[model samples]
Target: MRDRPVPQLPLALILSFLAVSGLLLLEDLFARPFTFLTGISFEAVRRGEMALLLGLAALLAARFVRRDLIHGLLERRAGKALPHLIGDVASLFVLVVGAAIIMTGVYGWDIGAVVAAGGLSLAIVGLALKDVILAVFNGAALNVENAFMVGDRVKIGEVDGTVVQSTWRSTTILTKARRLVTIPNIALGTASITNFDRPDKSEQRVIEICLDYDVTAESAERILLAGVIGAAGISLVDAPRVHAIRLDRDGVVYAIRYVIANHDLGLSSDHAVIKSILAHLRDAGIGVSYPKQEVVTAERRIRVADRTVDRRVLVQQCELFRGLPPDVQARIAEALIEQKVQAGAALIAAGAVRSSLFIVGEGLMKRLRARPDRPGFVEERYVATQAFGRRAFLSDLPHPAPIGAVTQSLVFELTRAAFAGILAAHPEIKVPLATNLARSPTLDITHATEVSALEARAERPVAFYLSLLDAIASSEANAR
Candidate 1:
């Protein structure tokens, strides 16, 4: 980072002294020669020297006042730009006064006449540039009030953006779309302005979502809260909140409010929150409400299929069981046990031995992993036809993550014992199953080793059964 420049009194004094000396030297050299040629006389040269000396002295004095008094006082109390602005205005005032004094005292001009003429000229100029003058005053007011600063996100009338520049004439804003807008200071002063980064850069953002009436308000709130909390760049100090603010014709409206760490992250945070909410709702089998009107005139007929055929269809829909032969697929489908899990139920916990592969038959489930930094969970959504726990079931490893039901769900579980019995009775199926398992992205040999080590230290029956499954899978892989 660049270091701040410090004022040097000795340097200013030396420069001032050299300027005065140069003026005196010019007067001595030109006074006699000019008087002899032009008849203007030596007195005029002396007067010019004095006038120059007065102006130089005023400039030197202004410099000293700014560096020694004004700057020191304002630097700490006001912001970085305000101190410089005050100093510049002060210096200009001193220089203007010094010029007036030089015209009256040195050249012997009438003070009253000068003041009257100057006042009239100023009045005419001010009238011609009234808008400009108002802008200057408005800018000064903004600086004094500390209304907003560069990099602050602000809304002025219809324009909303971060302040890129603030000047006496106009303030420039860089919008979210990357468009630059310049608004006159006077207009900003007259219009209502909202500063999102005032006092603190942290800002609260609200995300409104409409959910069907089928979802209870309490359940919606829980889902919304779970989505926002622990989101990247969101403020954790303030707890995230959800409110069922309105019940409209289409559905109930929910507002999810959360704080972002900085105004700059507002857009990204909003996107993340909305994405999370959608994922959560989808995982919970909840649908957003939309206007729909339907009429039924005839009775509907329902058809029931064979249980084994339904199970086979559900298994085949999953990518994990896609390429298996018909006979093998049928045998696997026969081994699956249909299970129903209620909402908010844990299907699997992290670091626990998982002996079964679960495929979603209906409804939704979510995979959650414990956050290392805090006592919270990060979730991933799973819907119908999705399969989880493939790594643990295939490699005989402990689950490295947890799975839970976000809503009441129907699932089909194929346990290691059930599959092992099939594989033992017909060893030919082991090679193809092992080949599919080996191709799985979740398969990790290291994870299997870690699970084996953990199981060897425990006397759990599940662990012993997992060891037997691991031996069978290893034999199949070796045979290949």
Candidate 2:
């Protein structure tokens, strides 16, 4: 709103009115004194009064020309408010035309003589202030063409920044390095500008990464897309995407593309997206590939940790399986399958029976449980290494609520028969787990609670373990 016409309008009109009144009242008071002092007739200089009156009227017309003619009428037709310089130019034109009318029309002055004198004066002033005049007109032209506006991120020549101010003389910008830069309007008019801001439109940014030759392009692209799908400051609804751009010297180059809501958050948004990509790659045990030129004296090998290793680690860390034999647990870990869920996709559906258990490998899941009092649902979350579907797998109950992926995630699925097959093959495996469960005060579960006929004494914990496993296995089979 800087240089807008409203503030100066009233002041211009008030000054014009005061000038007209003062000239009329002071004419009689100074006319006799002028005749006595200088011996020049008052009638001769009275035409000067007419000239002054016309000049005051011209100034008033100039203000109206600036506000209503240029700003209100022309700008409305142009779709956006143009640079203030255009209004100034139009107002100056009005003032000059009003002067020409007062001089030639009223006095019948010699047109050729007046033109010669005015032309000489204009040439001298124009030469002295050539750059200033050009800059003003350049600013007007830039606005007429609908160039970048204030707060728009632009790259004018080598400078990349947001336009903080646009004046007739220059455009000032706040750079990414946190410095202010001023680009003269003359230079700006000639320079190529890249405007990153567009009306009602968001921009898509691409992040490029290289991976080693051993890694499949499909898997890398999948992981990269997963990382960006729900990254902070990205447009999730726009559908972030990935592509295998090309084959590089050491590996395949991938481009992950995502939409950004605003251009001003460039640094923070990129930081978040890059951080997420690194995290997913780290969790998957994949190392980022750099330009490889180093010659090895010995053939050095870099090993990527397998998903089987991740499954075993999750199994060993789980409280439910901690007391089981290490070998038996390893076998159960081997039965796990990799599962992937996209952001906002449903992992578990309400009223659906689940026959497999899920352990989060990376990222997050949100459980939407209906609130006791509210009309809508509330959220519960599960992160890396946490598992779900215990009740469904153990007791064959349909899911009470839906579980959705909060971010693109990796999960390990354990089929219903994963534990049951292991127990049937090695029945002795249940002994250690049952003994540990009976000894722990925090784990008060027993077969007696499940079936009143079964005596759940500590001396016979193996019988309880067998019963528990059998019931769980049967429930899972029925659900399947």
Candidate 3:
């Protein structure tokens, strides 16, 4: 991949050769002309050539020192390599030593005597560049301590971002907003820095929510935990924590904390958790509380549209009934039992056989998986317009998980007996219904191995429904 072959001679050797050649060429071309025009001696030309050689030698020595002392050792260690600041300091030391040798050997100049004479001037310059000196020292300390490295996500005072570059002068940070911030090394050394990507790249984020006073601590915790588990980007290795921090006049405060595998995903993960929590609460018919002013309010009767018309509209929106004819849709709607469920009520118990599908009309519902070993439950939330209990109704299998209400909810319940009667009366819709069910992600035949075994004993229609239910249950298990 390299354009040029590796040099046989060292870089210093090559540099020395070039320096000598250039000096000889310069002397040959200009030495006699300058001696004649300016009446200067040839000896003066030799001295100038010697000084140029000494300067070149010093630079060459510095390069060798830098490569040997820093780059050479660092490259071999890979990720454990030391910072460039140390190499820079080592290179500078080499240059200073080289200069001292040049001064004393070439010109018979005493370096100590020169420094002694310019001590006052040196002090003035040192004072002027105090900040730069301090920064360099701080950078050195930081490198030695191994505080943080490039690519680390850190919060240093008001600036928060991933470190792009770290040097003797400053540390560069690239923020989420795409802004680049350069912080002086001295400032970084003095300030308190929180490194999210250090030790490990995982970070814990807290999602705070306020719920109505009616929600119990146990139910609230269950809902919060379920919401966190359902959210993507959350760390499954660590169980999420929910705390009821305070109770106010308006509501109860909850803090849901979970670990995210990546520090960069903190904000997005929090958003997902919030969305999931809201959905779960809505499914359970739970409402969030907000501060409101009290007034002498009077109850007034409000006019609403016909229940049959509303149910027909809802059935039209449902995926299962969407493709059905208008008359079939009306028949399904008529069979639906409109029920109002209170918060904390169980809609369906785990392992209980059910023959009805429940469609959410308003509010939230949580599906909880019983964990006998843990003494608590794992939950998933469904919101408005969503449907559950399809597998139980279709296959006549026990409910995979218990469904509970988080808030006061309104739902339309459709019994399998009612649906079966409709199917018997109109056999033309059976094929269409089966076709639609076949396409569902939760009803893939490949995942329903258990249902295949049951097919030998049960009738064709019954076996198909059982397989679909098994597939749905398998999918839910895999999701968790």
Candidate 4:
């Protein structure tokens, strides 16, 4: 005989019912009980059968209520408490507990002891993970506070990086060196942190300069203010100012300071402001100072020295003296005479009889246009040059343009006599006097004609006269 396949659930239910019915029938047949007791007329076997049917119905009801409805309710509650992993596990445990309760209560089995044991185990596990739970709490706090977001450059204690990821317990940061560093949330919360990108809407720009020691403090301040104001990318709200500070045995250090809008930082937009300041200083003939070092080959004590050059060679290289002939150049070179003026010396006064031209080779010279009675000089010009002076051989009436030096300058004197001699030799040298020249006479292109009458030439007399008038007008205009 071959074994039959196991019966299905429905078939098993039918078989169980039949077996119980048979047992009840045998119990009724073997032990006959009173059919009438307190006016009841049911057999003992029939009562037993009804009890068994009630038990089966209760089991089915308990399975639905405990395993399905109650389990689902507890699972939903646990799901809310655990967010990432713990919550899911808690939900599963709640579902398993509900199923156990249903099985024990409906089937008359004991499982309450097992439930107590499981609860004890869970308590022990929770105690061992106390630190992990605290970490989770810290992570939650970090997310809630939003102290720093992803891609934010933050410095915590000595660590600085861009926030890459944030979790409940830790954060990942990508450093400038392209390394990822993981840090605990609790540690980050306790450390000192700084964000470089803050204090929006305001920033400062600086231009460093080293001014010569001889420059007056007031003059340096005024020039710095002008330069900073004229520079680009400098905010108008923050006016420029200069700070003069002493250095170690060198000279005065000048800092041109101005503020810019913070949005312009690190964009190289504020560079133009610095560039403009430098250009302004250069245009005003203010030179940037460089370090000077002196070394003596053999000496008990080496003394610092200042070296000087002749101003004659300096003027030869100027653009103003270019294109002149060789002999004229020689005369101009030899005519340069050195003159010394004190610190407040007035070399030339406006409207005065302008005598020999003065060139500044060294030191400073000032030229003024205002009278002595004015509040200040109307025009003050400063000329500081290596070889700067007048060209030799010029008239006094039309004096060469006056220039002032601000330092000890080498000045060249060119008298009217020397200028006249050069002009007499170079007779072809003519100065431009006017824009318009005298008009030249028109050249008459016509000759006396024998057949002058238009009638003989078969031309209209009116047209011929008009053409002659137009030609005459054009010729006269050209001559003019």
Per-candidate TM-scores read 0.58, 0.73, 0.58, 0.35
Q: After superposing candidate 4, which stretches have Cα over 4 Å from the reference?
A: 1-146, 151-153, 158-164, 172-183, 197-201, 205-208, 233-237, 267-270, 294-480
Task: Residues 1-480, candidate 1: write the lDDT tens digits.
Answer: 112367766675568677767767776576677778888868887787788688778878788666656666555455443324456567778888898889888998988887788898999999999999998888878878888876678999999998877767888999989999999988977899899877788878888889877666655765677667524455544667789899888899998887766777778888887887776565455666767575646453221112223677666656667777777778888889977677679888888997788876654577764544457555555555567776677667899887777655667899876776666656665455555544544321112212333233322244443454567655555555
RMSD for all candidates, in order, please: 9.8, 8.0, 11.5, 23.9
lDDT of 2 at 444: 19
1-480 in candidate 4: lDDT tens per residue? 112233234555556667766666676653245343334445534654555645544444444454344334443553421122232233445556546544564455567676686898978987998667767767666545656555567777777777766655677778868899888767865777665445444556666677667555555654455455545554555555578866534457887666666543633635766676565455344555555574535333111011123333434433334445656657765765555554444555434454354533333344433233435333333232222222121213432234444333334555444444544455333221000000101001011122222112232244343343343334434545
Model 1 backbone overlap count = 0
Which regions of candidate 2 fall more than 4 Å away from where they truly are? 1-27, 60-82, 110-113, 116-130, 232-237, 290-326, 333-348, 359-367, 378-386, 403-412, 426-470, 473-480
Q: How accurate locally is residue 253 in candidate 1, as Cα lDDT from 0 to 100?
A: 93
* Candidates arranged by TM-score, highest first: 2, 3, 1, 4
- Candidates 2 and 4 compared by TM-score, better number: 2
The candidate that achieves the highest lDDT relative to the unseen native structure: 2
Residue-wise lDDT of candidate 3 within 77-181, one digit each (tens)? 554444567778888887787777777877789888999989999899999999999999999888778788766788999998887777789888999899999
Worst 10 residues of 2 by lDDT: 444-453
Can you list the residue pairs that collide in candidate 2? Answer: none
Model 4 Cα displacement at 306 (Å)?
Answer: 21
Q: What local lDDT score does residue 206 receive in model 3, on the 0 to 100 scale?
A: 81
Report RMSD for candidate 2: 8.0
lDDT, each prediction: 0.69, 0.70, 0.69, 0.48
